[model samples]
Target: MPEENYDFMMPNVNFFGPGVVKKVGERAKMLNMKKVLIVTDTFLRDLDNGPVKQAESSLLKADIAYVIFSGVEPNPKIRNVKEGKKAYIDNHCDSIITIGGGSAHDCGKGIGIVLSNGDDLPALAGIETLENPLPPLMAINTTAGTASEITRHTVITNEKTHLKFVVVSWRNVPLVSFNDPLLMLDIPTALTAATGMDALTHCVESYVSVNRNPITDAQAIQGIKLISKYLRRAVANGHDVEARTNMAYASILAGMAFNNADLGYVHAMAHQLGGQYDAPHGVCCAVLMPTVEKWNIISNPERFSDIAELLGENIAGLSVMEAADKSVEAMIRISEDVGIPTNIKSLGALPEDFDKMAENALKDGNAFSNPRIGNKEDIINLYQQAYKA
Candidate 1:
C-alpha cells in the first residue's frame, strides 16, 4: 500500500454561529475591501429576509458598497463567472462576497481568479495552475453542505464543453468563511436533505481517497458520525436548530478533510451529471452514493466497514466485508428517509449516454483519488446502476 500523507489547505479565517451573517461587513473592512461584487442566485438576492438581507445590512453598516450579480444558476456555469467578472470590472469592485451554496461560491471563485490573474477561466482548470493571487473573497454559506465556502477547490461548469472542470489552488480559498445555521432554517426539507447527503458523501469519499491521511481520517470519521446522527432529524424538521448546526459543523469537518484528502468517483460522475443537465449536485451525489460505494468497498473493506458502524449499522456478528456491505445499505435507507430521488432519469441522462459520460468521468480530477482505479467500462457500469437506482 502507498503511504498516505497530505498538505491541508484551509480558509484564512472562519466564523460560525447563528448571527455571524451580520459580521461579514466587519471582515470585509478588515480585508480592506472598498467595493465588492456580491455573487448570489436570484432566489437568494430576492429573498425578503435571509442571508442576503443580513449581508446587505452588515455591508451598509460597515460602509462597504457592493454590486449585486444575481445570475448564478443552480449548477453554476462558466458564463455565470464571466458575467460576474464583468459586473465586478464595470462596477469597479475591489473584492467579492459570495452568498448561498456551492453555485454562488464557485461562481465567485471563478470571477475572483480571473479578475486578479487576468487569465482565462479555462487556463486555470487544473491543480495549482493559477499564477497569481485571486482577489480577496469572503464566502457566506447558507446551506450546510457543499462546503464551497471553505475549500480550496472550485468546480466550474464549461458551457460550451459541458464539463465541470476542477480548479485546485490555495489562492482561491475564501479569505473568510462564515457558516450561520439560522440562514438555513427556511430551506425546503428536500433541499436540506439533498445538501446533507452531499456533505455525507464528502466525508465517506475522502475517508477512502488515495490522499487520505491521519488528520483527514479523524475529521471524516467525526463528520460521518455527525451526519449519521443528525441528517434524518434535520430533514424531518428544518426548524431544528441543533440538527442544522451539527450538519453545518459536519460540513466544515468534511470540507477540511476532503480539501486535503480529495474526493472519488462519486464526485466525478456527479459532476458530469451536473454539467450535462444542470442537475442538482447534491441530489446526484445522494442518488449515486450506494451504487458507487458497493463497487468501491472491495478496495478498502476496513474503511468501508468503519463507515458502516459510523452510519449506525449493527455489525456485532459480521465480518469486515459483511459490515462493509452494510455501509451501502445504510446509505440507501437514509436516502429514502431523506427523500433523495431513487432515479436520476429526470435529468434526461439515459443509458445510451453512459459511455460518453464515463469517458469524461475518467478524466475528472476527483477520479485519481478513488480507491478503485477503473476504466471507462467500470464507470459506465456505475452510471447504469445509478440510473436505474
Candidate 2:
C-alpha cells in the first residue's frame, strides 16, 4: 500500500506581538504594493483609535496609497465580496490589506479570489478550486478567533440562498499575517468569550480530526493548554496583556493545526447556523462543540482523553471511556464559564430549520474530516441535542 501523506499550510510571513500593526506599511512597501485596498468593517473603520487608523498611519509613513472598503458584514456575504472587488478594480489596487477579525480576512480573500479568477464567487466553492494566485494580501487580525489570517480557507455567504460556502486553496492564504494583542484589548467581553472558545473548538476538533498528524497534534495540544489557561482571564479583564498575548498565540496555533489537519463536525454544523441565522460564527461553534464532541468521542477515545488532560480535568482514576467523556464536560464547563449561551435556541434557531441545516452541514467541507461517521438522522439529532443543551 502507498504511504499516508498530508500537507501543511500557513501564511508566507507572520508578525505577532503588542505593536506589530506598525509594520504593515513597510511590509506592503517591501512587497511593492502600490495603491492598496484596505478591507474592513464600518465599525473598525469608524473607531477613533482602532486598528484601521493605526494601519493607515503605517501605510502613510511608508508612502503607500490605499482605498478603504468597510462594507464587510458579520458573516461576509457575496455582495460584500462583489463590492470589494469593485473597489479594488476602481482604485487600481495592486495589493490588499484586511483589518479586523475573520470577517474582514475572509471578505478580503473572497474579493481577491474573484478578481484573480472570475466574477462567479459561488461557482468557486470547495477545496483547491482556485487556479490563479491572489494579489499580495496582508491580514491584520483584531480578534483572537477564526484565524482566517493564516489559513487557506475562507467562508462566504450567499445572501440569496442563505447558505455559507467554504473556499479552500493554497493560493488564498494571505502573504502576511499580523496578530497584535494590543488591538484585541478593546474587544467586548462577550466577543472575547466567543472568539476564545472558538479557538478552543479549533484545537479540539483538529486534534481529533481523521487527517491529524504529528505536527498538527503538537500544535493542537498546546493550543488547548493555552486556551484553557488564558481564555477566562482575557474575558474577565480585556486589559490583561498576558492573557491577550497568549490567547493570540493560542488562536494562531489552533489555526496552524486546523489549517492542515482540517476541522470536523463542529465547524460543519456551526456553518449552517451562521448562514441560517446570520449569527456569530464563534458563538455558534462554542454552543455546538460539546454536543458534537460527545458524539465524536467514540471515534478516538485516546484523543479525547488527551484533550481532557489538557483542559485540566481530573481523570486519573477513570477508564478511557470515562476520561474521554470528561473532554466534553471540560468543554461545557469552560464554555459556560466564558458566557456562551446554553443552547442554539437562544441564537434564534428553530426546529423546522434543523433538517435543512443538517443537510447543508453534511455537505460542508469540514464534515469529511470529522472523526465519527454518521448519517442525516444522526446529524439532525446532534442539532436537537445542541438546541436543548
Candidate 3:
C-alpha cells in the first residue's frame, strides 16, 4: 500500500479557560477591525449577563463598534446567512464575531463567504468553493459542541431544496476561537447532553474515516475518552466547572480531528434530518450515530474496538468483532443515559422522506470520507434502523 497525504486545519489561535471571552475585543482591535458584526441567536443576544454582553463590554472598552445580528436560527439556513450579510453590509462592519454555538458560527462564516465571494450560497456548497479570503472572524463558543468555532467546515441549509450542504475550506477557519467554560455553565441539561454526544460522534466518525491519519486518530481518541468521562457529569450539573472545561477541550479536539480527517455517514445523514425537520443538529447526530457506526464497523473493526474502550466499554477478553460491536452498544447506552430521543421518529423524521434525505446525504461533502461507501439503499436502511432503534 502507498502512503496517503493529509492536511490538518484549525483556527490560527484558540483560547480556553474561564472568562477568556474578555479577550474578544482586544483581539478584534489587534486584527484592525473597525466595526464588527456580532452573529448570534436571539436568546443569547437578549440574555442578561451572558457571554454576548461580556463580548459587547469588551468591544466597547476597546472602542470597537459592533452591530448585533441575532437572526441565526438552529440548523442555520440560507436566509439567516443572507440576513447576517445584509447586517454586516448595512452596518459597514469590517469583521465578524460569532457568539453562541454552531448555528451562529456557521451563519457568520456563510455571511463572510458571500461578502467576499458572491451571494450564491447554494453554488458554494462543495469543498473549497471559496476563491477569496473571508473577513476577520472570531468565534466565541458558548456551547461545547459543533466546534464550528475552530473548524473549516460550515453546514448550511438551503431553504429552497430543504437540504443541508457543507462548505469546506481552510479559509472558513476562524482567525481566533474562544472556549470559555463560564459561558457554557448556563447551558440547559438537554443541550449539554446533545452537544456532548455530537462531539463523541465527531470523534468516532473521524477515527474510522478513510482519511484518518495519526494526528486525527490521536485527537479523536482523546476526545472520545474525555466525552465518556465528563459528558454525563456536565449534563447532570451544568455548573460543574471541571466537566465543562473538559468537555470544551473535547469538542475542540473532535473538531480538529474531523475538520481535517473529515466525517462519515452519521454527520451526512444527520444533516439531512436537520435540513428537513429543522431538528436540533446535535440530537439528530446522537440518535443516528450508533446505527451508522454499526454499518461502518465492518470497514475498520480495530478502530471500532478502540472506540469501544475509549467510550469506557469493557472489551477485555472479547474477539475483535465482539469488541467492535461493543462500540455500538456503548453509543446507545450513552444516548439513553443522556436522555436523548430513542429514535429519529420521535424527532419528527418521516420514513416517507428517507428516500430524498438518503439521496442528499450521498452528495454531502462529508460523505466522501466515510469509511463505508454506502449506496442510497444502504443509507435508507441505516435511517430505518435508527428510526426503530
Pick the lDDT winner. 2
RMSD per prediction, one decimal?
Answer: 1.3, 1.3, 1.1
Per-residue accuracy of model 3 over 289-364 as CA lDDT, tens digit each:
9889999989889989999999899998999999999999999999999999989999999999999999999999
Candidate 3 all-Cα RMSD: 1.1
Q: After best superposition, candidate 2 residue 358: deviation in angstroms? A: 1.0
- List, residue by residue over 291-311, the lDDT tens digit for candidate 2: 999999988898899999999
Q: Rate the local accuracy (lDDT) of all candidates.
A: 0.90, 0.94, 0.92
Model 1 per-residue lDDT at 188: 90
RMSD of 1: 1.3
Clashing pairs in 3: none
Which stretches of candidate 2 lie above 4 Å from their native place? Answer: 1-3
> What's the TM-score of every candidate structure?
0.97, 0.98, 0.98
Model 1 Cα lDDT, one tens digit per residue, 293-381 = 99999999999999999999999999999999999999999989998888778667888778878998888889999999999999998
Estimate the TM-score for candidate 3.
0.98
TM-score of 2: 0.98
How many clashes in each candidate? 1, 0, 0
